[model samples]
Target: MTDQTEPVGEVDALMRQAALDAERLLSGLRMFVALGLGLFFLVAVKPADALQEPVLLRQWAFAGSTMMGYFLLGLLTWILSARGLFRMWGVWVVATADTLFVLSGLWLSLMNTGLEPGAIFVFPSAWLVPLVLAFAVIRGDPWVMAFTVAVLCLGLALLAIGGAESGQQGRRETLDLFLSLPPNVMRLAMIALAGIVLVTAARRVRRLLLRSIRDARSRANLTRYLPAQLADDLGEVGLAALQRGSRQEVGLLFVDIRGFTGMTQEMPPEKVSEFVSDYRRRVSAAAEKTRGIIDKFMGDAVLIVFEGDGAARRCLDCGLMLRADIADWSKARTMRGDAPVRVGIGMHWGEVFRGVVGDANRLEYSVFGDAVNIAARLESLTREMEMDVIASRDLIATAKAEAGSLGFIDLEPIEVRGRTGALALSGVAKDAPLRSAGTAAPVSGSSS
Candidate 1:
């Protein structure tokens, strides 16, 4: 059986890389936030005013402990990512650590500021709501964000009730505190609102990230069946273009490896696959240079379509370039002690229908009509005529003045299979002497 491990390994590696990158980002943000919070606490405490309220020392102590805890946690997360352990549930570790730190930081802030009239309390602690929510967003999981918000609300409610009781206030005063509702109710409402906003924002960002990840996966999958450029265009243009069949004049280029079947008959499956893959890669590279969209691959043959203005010219240019590319590729293969490869290509330009085909569950985008058929017939004629490339007279004529400059050998009209009349064809030798115009030059220095 063919090995499937390589592709799976690649995907796993990509996911791990994404996770590690996220961990590193969160770690840096954690350190910055911790340091900022520490400075804020230091400024609020005002060492000069400490003499006036000896209680301020306790506040400073709490702030110091909270900040130090945050720094240590951040350091731990960074080390985990550096050691590559962050890929093993690092998101959860960061989220849990950050959630706890924020919750504790809120409590410490609340206690230090005090609940008494004329003394700061809820506002200082409320600043952390957005920070914790920010952590939720960075985590990129709605459940984690929701969990953080829920725990924070519970913590705030407990702190409010607990602080009022701890003051040893009378039952009436305790009831009055709950009913007053300015700081407590308002603080809870703000937390809820902030949680809603942050969670909504996080969910939106998570959706976008998910879409990007899905798109990447889809592109990877599509490349297996379609040309990379065509797959990308399909994504950009959307399937709607295919759902409605349309006809447009397009340049069709059909490429088939000469003697590929006979050459691979005696080879092992692995070697055959490798050889075909290498040939396809070279053809794809050359075709892409001329803005050709790969229509499909049928066995050892590739069908490419060139649409829009100047399609015919691009198609012929691409064919000449492919001839040069194959020459260099064959030479490199011979140098490496491998069998030299040869290909036959045919170019035709005509109106073809483009649309989606197949059932709803397994729809396919394809092109049809005489344009595609003529291109295939010409490709087959390349072998019978003992020529490397062939172009229909119509394609040459449609290309304007392009065919004349390339020095193509005109041939008599030849009957093609499944067609009533013979097609006027011209042949271009693979090693045709390069003209001064250099139309057949390979687009890139490295053909392989």
Candidate 2:
């Protein structure tokens, strides 16, 4: 049994690890594509112009220098992508390189004696590309986005002001003269294209912001079920898995504060709320610590699920630790002349159907199966059998022999409802001495 189980566990572990590796690979691919495409656009827009003659060789050398700077910027982007670094420093590096490349081209265009109308349009477009790319890569930082927006606005404003100044000097054609012509139409066309790009980028950013907000809310909700580490894993894996149901064996646990109703009856509404809140906090802490998913909270009860024995054992340990903590809490409350609370916990191992359920407006990621039913029944049985903790025969059989040393004692076989086969019930006393195995005893209750 151990041999067969061990291999299956190893295979599952390997598959999970492979999925993580695949995600990292995809992220790297996206980074490369983003950089590569940006570079391709830059090169396509501005081809190096050729020069002739000895006197013009100096001009050629100057043009070559600008092209060299552009290539260097691309090289820097590739290097950053290869390093697999994600930080503000990388954003700054890329932004600086891109700015320098744009400014160099702008300077060359300004110095050129015979600048074509096309060159003027291309120069600003080149600057726009890098600014937009930098903004996209570092959108998480508000400062970066602010800087990009400021720069684009400043650049456009300066162009408008400069055009106005040139028109006023009477050295250039009047603003109206250019506006009425076919070349003016081309200039308007370029401006229209740039406007489209800006609108598209703004829409993209808006969608991204909405997604970020939704993700933050989803994560806050998920933390109710998962620990910080597991929550991070789930987020990295994304919501697609939850949307599509998956088949897997998982350990389910159900816990209820025994005598909670009686305790609540003895207190005022406010005091009852306080007590329930404290109980939830304690149980939630324990569940998260053990990597158990608290599927649902029903009045005074909590339904938790563990992925496997490793997770289940952790949950068991958490339950034991929680019992000790609650005992300490009860003692403190008694010392202060306050009320105490008792808790009943049950665990079972079985295959579960896990997925998102409900309508589009109100969907929830949950687990459903006979395993969940059995775990609930076990919790219900805890009240009848006067046991603080109860587990199924499946859990007991799967548990390591050392687990029995941890105060797990096999109880009598009992038939559960909706099932033809009888099951071996087990119990572990809250304050029982560790490593003591007691005799199995029959339980007297109808299976839930």
Candidate 3:
């Protein structure tokens, strides 16, 4: 079984980072609110001391202290984010602390000012609860939003109960003054409504984020078996396209590392893995450069396909590049006193059936047709012909690639296994140069 810890860990880390970013954004807004409130107290309100009372001065001091605490908490949030510790746990701790701060500040305001329930509703700090709720919702976690709402509601309920007990007479006296609108009831109602909306929004947002993370992880996993571009294309195809198979004329290219079995027989398993890894990387690079999509890796061979316009030309170009790349790799290995490497490639162009197959639970995208079989046979025949690269004559003709430009030697038609009539083909030397379709001349080589 393939170990999935690495990809899962990566997705988890991204989610944590996103959560931290949301926290920092909310913290910055909190700091701005604190600064605005502090400035309002210092600049907007005037001290009317005609009655020689110090109540206003004390009120200013309390408000300043509360705002200072808010600012400091925002700063702490920033510090935690900088240290990379503002994750889910940090969210719980910081949210709890903020609830306590707001509750304590409100309690002190009620005790000192003797404000009735109606007056408390108009206080600047009363809006902090909704702001905190908004922050929790933006964090995209339903549980965190639920916790914030519970704490806010519990604190407010406790305060309301205590206020009613102590100031029953005051509220009763004002009952006649404000008969149509009850501030306490309305305030609690608004809190409930906001919590419902915010929590619902948070739950929806959480679902979306979860889905996006899953999609990103799926794309990453696909790239492990397919090329990056092909993985992206598959994602765009979606479930509908995958459910229905499609057929199109495509260029098929098969590549196999020559004598790989004999080479690995004398080497350690680690060395064999290194050799295969290097070979696959080189093949992938060549395929990408030529716009070929790798179909699958069959042990020591790689099957790639090219579709869309000019696929045949792309397949031929990929084969030539693969030959050159392996030649360079073989020379480097020989210099290092390592086993010399060689690779074989076969290219053919024909109609291919391409789509997802297998059961619903194990659907796989694949290519199937006689063209694939012919490409495989040609790759196997490379060993018998003592050549590194071979392309079907039909592929060369379809691509309109000049033999001189491709620097390939035209070879006699050879019979392929399980196919009627002989198939004409051509071979290219491993160290050929890249050139356009009509400008360059062919390099002399034996057709042996």
Candidate 4:
């Protein structure tokens, strides 16, 4: 049993790690593609004859050198992407390339010989690529927005300086150029428009980043109420989606502190909070270890759910282990003169509909029907039976028979509210010996 379980556990861990690696690799590839395409457009386009003059060449050299540098930077980006370097580094490499490209375009526009203003056309488009890339790569970082704004300002400054220089050369007057006939005025208009667009884009990016950050923070906070798995699922699919309903067999486990109300009354609010936090941490660790999703925490109680039959058995095993852990934890607290805590847990299994339900303003992913209610009742039963752990007959029947190695006892039938038929239940001792001591606790309970 140990041999079989060990390899399976190792394999699952490996698979998860591999999936994360693949996602990072894909992100790197996306950055590379965006940078590569932008660079290609800049490098492939030839300089016009009018801008080929000696004065312009000297100016174009700055642009040319900058472009070549960006090309090399893009090459470096590809190398990092291909090598699958760190995600932060990959993002930075592309960001750097983009900055250089925008800088080069600005330099070229500055040195523009009035004869070929057409060369300035690429600056706006080129700058846009990096701005977009920066938003994509490091949306959380305000520095990306700062850098984008800096680039926009630099581009505007160059255009203004070039326009002034052209005016002195009898090409056109600066203010008149701004108000003059459609073409030159349009060119000036475009430069102004580009700055506005870039700034707007940056603001939009910042807003998007803030929204993402808020969502992440909310999800993190929600994880305290729900299991990490369910929290993540809620973040991805949303509470409304999950509440819609699905038929799947699930093992539900409920755990509540014995005499929790009395304990809280005896302690200060801060201490009560600390006590609850500590209990949650210990139980959550065990549940997560068994791949359990916490549904919710109601006062001193925690609801956990495990997905599959095998997982359900694992959850039951974990729950029993958790009881022992809690006992030890309580002993440690008692030695420290802190209040000791006792928990009663119950497990049940049945087909149920699970989904998210709520209005636009609020939402929650929760399970529905008699199965969930029965699980809650079973948890209540634990306090009455003087047992630390109880399991419904549904859980026992669904779990593989070999699970008997974990030590479960058959119990009398229980009639629950809202359900017409009586349901059989069982009990498991907290002190039950394990076949293997290190198995992780599994998740149990409805996610609500």
Candidate 5:
């Protein structure tokens, strides 16, 4: 399984997904605007007879082409979004396409008017530039808004230059009073200033959107640790599930950082915080790989729960991965002249009481039984035994792995605190691979 080492990449990926979802919805609206509604406006605004002429015919065709392009693009984006094939680049491309089409329509108007290029700004289509640029603010990216503005300014500038250089100096008398080079330059300046305003607006909107998405993702991460089935059982979907307990066979895993208390006692608060965050991130990656849910964490210790079929197998894999990963981390720290770190993992498989408690204000999903207690106790045993990993015989047997497989070595029954009887167990080292063989002991045990 791929490991999630960098959280920033994950957050950026989430933002892209959110942007594509918004784009798909915007595409649906664009479909409506491009076809029926646009046609209604076209028919009411322009006389049908005018389109019969060659010049008007060309403009009409361009408008029709723009509409068709809009419809097709909208449909394509919707289909891609449905298939989960659309990417952030596609969003930028669509923004560029729409901007091109809007400006192209106005560009087509200059050829139809039979007037000087100075009259291009006087044409009614010129009003659409700002409106289309404003439309990009919905995209929630300041860069896309800036891109639209760049394209718009470039198109308008080219049109103005072409008008000044055109061989035909003829102009419409009605607009001659206000359509001089000075007025056109002033209008271009206004467009530039308006672009700045829109870009500023986009930045503010995008900042709020990113902040909201980050906050939502933080809350969503909690659900990842709390399984959906557990949530369903905990009254998130219905009130009936509240204050009720259900029995579930689960693989319980408990992890504790070796010497964490002493390590933190010597470090500053900021350093301790950074160290703990890094430690949790490492364990979380291992848990994610094994499909284990971290039920709860207290500073340097975490309680993970694996349920259903193969829970024991996954739990063991999680422990093995965690130990291996933490070992690598410790080595990296040692090379950097920082204090080394280690973790002890304990695993047990048994039935537990699982359920939620409290009101709408607060709720907790608690897994309580001998299984959890035994798992925590075994973790403490790791320090005394000089073992990085340990599991009860019952857990190993449930995994159904063969002896000398999965790095499991049979061990004599070990006395655990708060327990009257000694429990049969298995042990492994930090560097051992989960599926690799290890020297087995003569002590009797179950399948594992």
Candidate 6:
């Protein structure tokens, strides 16, 4: 059996691309921030405000250089990411650079102000730590967020050596909470708490994104073998819910290409494949048009099930459409000196066990019962009766009452083996050498 679960590697690949896009967006935003801050320092802040002491102007020069470096690096990263040159590992590199640039600006600004190192907590630049962490969140990688927060907290601790008044010993009650070492210690704790929450939220978002991708792949797989509508219903209700099979009255149609084996015995493998593919396409189109569920197709034979109201009538119409289409296709092949393709259809309507079956290791939607068996039996007789379509009397009766009697020839009733009584059958046909000289009578078993 083929693997059904969506691969985790595929999910990871999608997330990697998403992370790249997020990083590029964060970089572009950072460039604007750097540009604005740099311009503010250059034009808005006067020289006296920028340099408390004329001699400290040299330190401010280094700070200004860091800002310029930040802007240039952000722009380059953004461009590289857009061109698909950036890698996942590069996210941590960018995060470190961003934290350092902001930290140096605050540290240098404090240096010029001559405030005790502890006063860095009151500096406006400290708020940028939260913004940096927020950008990390956009990357949707918890590891990146945790790394940025860890770096910022460490930098804050080093800057806060003893954040206390002279001889105060950094006592929590004595030193101003907002300005001193002890309170800012508590503030750092809060920041760590917030980081933890954001990281948790980001992890949850990643899981949800992966689940969405997995579900989409699974739905596509279902559509591959089942009808589009059935697949859609299963997706909405969920496959687990379908594990408990239900008894449903459905119109069952079984069809197989007549003489497929002998006709393709001498044909090349390519031709044989083409013949089967073409045959299925025609039948599927007809089935879809009538809203029939292509329960499954085993090689050249397909078992179709019609559901809901008026299923019997719709199934009959589908069979008729398929018969004529295959006949027309066969005639064209005959003209081309290729073997003609022909099919036989058997249809029945009744209650059947329909739902998913098997253990969790293997599960499939299936339909089986006496009704399904009767349908197959009828299709098998199509060859013996020299007919292209054979349908049960009960199915004909249902369709006739629901819509109107379909165009089918009344054939002699035959005794089906393993059944209690004879089954009244009918057919629509042309001719076949398989027809026996004996009249229609007791017959059992079928190739269908």
Q: List TM-scores for all candidates, in order.
A: 0.52, 0.54, 0.54, 0.49, 0.50, 0.51
> All models: lDDT?
0.69, 0.57, 0.71, 0.59, 0.69, 0.70
Residues 334-365, candidate 5: write the lDDT tens digits. 87888988888888888888766555556566
Reference-based TM-score, model 2: 0.54
Which segments of model 2 are wrong by more than 4 Å?
Answer: 1-54, 57-230, 336-340, 417-421, 434-448
| Candidate 3: tens digits of C-alpha lDDT, residues 193-252 | 446546655775787779999987876765554455455455555645654778888899
RMSD of each: 15.1, 11.9, 14.7, 12.7, 10.8, 16.1
Clashes of each: 0, 0, 0, 17, 0, 0
Candidate 2, residues 1-448: lDDT per residue as tens digits? 0112344575566545433332233233334433443444334322332222322233344545654555455455545445644343555555444444544444444344233323334333343344354334433445555665566555544543442222224323322222334324434443443454455546655876798799889878765554454454456456566667777777778888877778788798998888889878877887777767778789998888777537556656665656555666676777778876677888888788986666545656688888889888888887787777888868756644344655667777778787779977778775564221122232221111
What is the alpha-carbon RMSD of candidate 3 to the true structure?
Answer: 14.7
lDDT of 4 by residue, 1-448 (tens): 0112344575565545443343343344334434553344344433563154454444435544654564465455556545765455444445555555665555455445443343344333344444444333333345655665675566656654453244334344422322334324323433443454446546655875698799888777665544456654565456555666577778888898999898788788898888889888887887877777777778888888777537667667667767767877877888788777778888888777766556555555567667777778888887787777788766766665443555566677877776679887777654554333234333232111
RMSD of 4: 12.7
* Candidate 1 Cα errors over 4 Å, as ranges: 1-188, 207-224, 243-245, 265-271, 331-341, 359-364, 414-424, 434-448
Candidate 3 clash pair list? none
lDDT of 4 at 203: 69
Q: Candidate 5, residue 319: CA error in Å?
A: 14
Cα lDDT for residue 315, candidate 6? 84
Q: Which 10 successive residues of model 5 have the least lDDT summed?
A: 439-448
- The TM-score, computed over Cα atoms with residue i paired to residue i, of candidate 1 is 0.52
Better of 2 and 5 by lDDT: 5
Best first by TM-score, ranked: 2, 3, 1, 6, 5, 4
Off by over 4 Å in 6: 1-190, 213-230, 233-243, 357-364, 396-406, 409-426, 429-448
Error (Å) of candidate 5 at residue 126 is 2.0
